[model samples]
Structures are given as C-alpha cells and as structure tokens.
Target chain A: DVKVTQSSRYLVKRTGEKVFLECVQDMDHENMFWYRQDPGLGLRLIYFSYDVKMKEKGDIPEGYSVSREKKERFSLILESASTNQTSMYLCAREVGANYGYTFGSGTRLTVV
Target chain B: DQQVKQNSPSLSVQEGRISILNCDYTNSMFDYFLWYKKYPAEGPTFLISISSIKDKNEDGRFTVFLNKSAKHLSLHIVPSQPGDSAVYFCAATDQTGANNLFFGTGTRLTVIP
Candidate 1:
C-alpha cells in the first residue's frame, strides 16, 4: 500500500506566522495534491504538483503556495497564517488517472 | 459554485438496517465517480467507484448505484454496523482532461446499536 506521510499531525501557529506543512510519499507517484477539509465544504484542493519543479493552483489557492523540489516530497506554505486557515490539511497521491487517491493521515492546523 | 453536492449533511440508521447516502453532480462531463469514508481525525479512505458506462458496482457489503440521466449516485450499505459510522464523501472527475476530482460536502452516517 502507498503511504503518504504528513510532517505534523497537529500544529498551532499565531496570526501572521509563517506555516509550513510537509508531505512525503513512499511510492513514486508523480501527482501530489494538497486539500483543506472544512465542515460543509468537503475537501477543497489548495494546490497540486505533477512533477518535480512543477506545480498548479487548484480551486482554492488564495493564501497558499506549494513546493515540489523533489519527487518524493511536496510542501505547502502559508506566508502569513490566519484564523481562517485553521482547518484539517490532507496530502494525497494519485495512483493513476482512473484510480482513487491515497491520502495521508492529515494535519489539523489551528491558527490563533 | 459547487459541482458536486451531497444534500444530506447527516444520516442515522439502525444497526442491521440499510443505509443509503445520495450524491448529485451538476457537471455532465464527469465520467468517473468515487466514494470515500472518513473517520474522525483521519483522512478519507477510498470505498468504491463506478464509471459512466455502468449503472451499478458492488464490493462486499457496499454498493454504488449511478443514474446518468439525473447525474445522481448513491451508496448502499446493507446490515449496517457501528464500525461503519463515518463521514461519506462522493467525488467526481472528468477523465478527458487533468482528471481533477470535485468532491461533495459529505454526509455523516451514524449507526445506532
């Protein structure tokens, strides 16, 4: 089975603080995604990387950025964290075009 | 605008009964549909999936039914158990392009013993 690991299981940051959420996949899947899970909003894609040094913005990418310097690791960056950014963040890797994504355990962020 | 929607926010079912979770999509271009189950403090896990060419797909106790005309899909879990309680989300994707999935809000299912 594919294992997607998040660097932090829980994080708390003050307003205006910079936040970094890291994700690493054991498998060699090319597609990696970041999503925020909010009540009543489901999982909204923040950003995705299809390859090393390549990235694309998703539906909701306003206050977030991503880095995929290497194939095995993908990171999400919040230049200035805010209360609204307090939500569960998930990392997922696409097994294939026609298959389901394998997700990490998730990181619960609390920006106060 | 939300392309996929799960109207019901929560559903309660008695143990040993049937639980049905419904989902609808506004995008007709979506050809692949998937269902995921999420427990508290964990990411969603893949449950089952169906393609546009088929109307029904089943795996053990979980079954998914799709209606192309209405752009609706449903998951049926027979003989519900307490362990089955979780938030269920339905996602759809158009395979023609990037295949990015649009997910529904999700329905929280609680099974009473």
Candidate 2:
C-alpha cells in the first residue's frame, strides 16, 4: 500500500502568519499534489509537482505556493494566512496511469 | 465555471437499501472518470473508476455507471452500511492532457440504521 503522510493533522495559525503544510510519500511516485477542500466547493488544486524542482500552479494558486526539493516530499506554503484560508488541506501522490492517486490523512487548518 | 457538478448536496438512505450518488461533467474531452470517498478529518480515498470505453465498473458493493451521451455518471452502493456514510466526489480527466482531474462539489451520503 502507498502511504502518504501529512506532517500535521490539525493546525491553527493567526492571520498574516505564514504557514507550512508538509507531505511525504513512501513510494517513488513522481507526481504529488496539494488541494484545499471547502464546503460546497469540492477539492480545488493549489499546486502540483511532477518531478523534483518542477512545480505547476493549479486552478486556485493565488495565495499558495509549493516546494518539491526531494522526490518523496512536497510542501505547501501559505504566504499570509487568512480566515478564508482556513480549510482542510489534502496531499496526494499519483500511483500511475489508470491506478489513480493515494492521499494522505489530511490536515485541518484554521486561521484566526 | 465548474466543469464537473454534483447536483445533490446530500442524500439519506436506510441501511440495506441502495444509495445512488450522481455526477455530471460539461467537458466532452474527458475520457476517464473516478469516484472517491472521504471520511471526516481524512483525505478522500479512491473508490472506483471507469474508462470512457466502458459503461460500467463494479467492485464489491460499489458500482459506477457512466452515460457518455448524457455526460453523466452515477455510483450505486448496494446494501449500504454505516461505514459507507461519507462524502463522495466525482472527478474527470482527459488522459491526453496533463492528467489534472476536474472535481465535482461532492455529495454527502448518510446511511441510516
């Protein structure tokens, strides 16, 4: 089984503070993604990395950025946290074609 | 504009009955569809999937039916159990592209005992 681990299960940060959400995978999957889940909005991709040091912006990449320094780790950075940025953040690693993705347990972030 | 839509926000069904969650997509280019189940505080888990070439795919008590003409798909859970209660999301992607999935808002299914 593929294990995708999110460093934090829950986090609370003050507005204007910077936040970092870390995700690490046990496998060698090259594709990793960060998404934020909101009520009635579904999962919106924030950023994705296809390979080490390669990153692409997803649909909603306004206030977020990503870093993929190594093959197994992907990190999402919130430049300046806000109340609206509070959401359940998810990390996923693609297994391969047709196999779909394996997701981490998730991190619930709250910005006050 | 949302490319994929889940019209039903929530559904409640009695245990041992069938629960159907629906999804629709506007993009005709999408060639692959997938269903995921998410529990509270947990990331969504891949449940089942179907290729555009096939109309139906089944796994255990879960079956996904796709209608290419209508650009719609549905997931049916038979003999629904309490464990089946979760948020179901439908996603679509064009394999020819970057493989970025377009996701629906999701439907919350509640299985009553």
Superposition error at A97 for model 1 (Å): 3.6
> Isolated chain A: TM-score per model?
0.97, 0.97
Model 2 DockQ reads 0.73
Each prediction's whole-model lDDT (CA): 0.93, 0.93
Candidate 1 Cα lDDT to native: 0.93
Which residues of candidate 2, in runs, are more than 4 Å off? B97-99
- If you assessed candidate 2 against the hidden native complex, which CAPRI class would it receive? medium
Docking outcome class, model 1: medium
Per-residue accuracy of model 2 over A1-112 as CA lDDT, tens digit each: 8999999999999999999999999988788999999999999988899999999999899999899999999999999999999999999998755757889999999999
Worst lDDT 10-window in candidate 2 chain A? A93-102
- Model 1 quality (TM-score): 0.97
lDDT tens readout by residue for model 1, B9-93: 9999999999999999999998899999999999899999999999999999999999999999999999899999999999998
Candidate 1 regions off by >4 Å? B97-99
Error of 2 at A59 (Å): 0.9
lDDT of 1 by residue, A12-108 (tens): 9999999999999998879899999999999999999889999999999999999999999999999999999999999999876556788999999
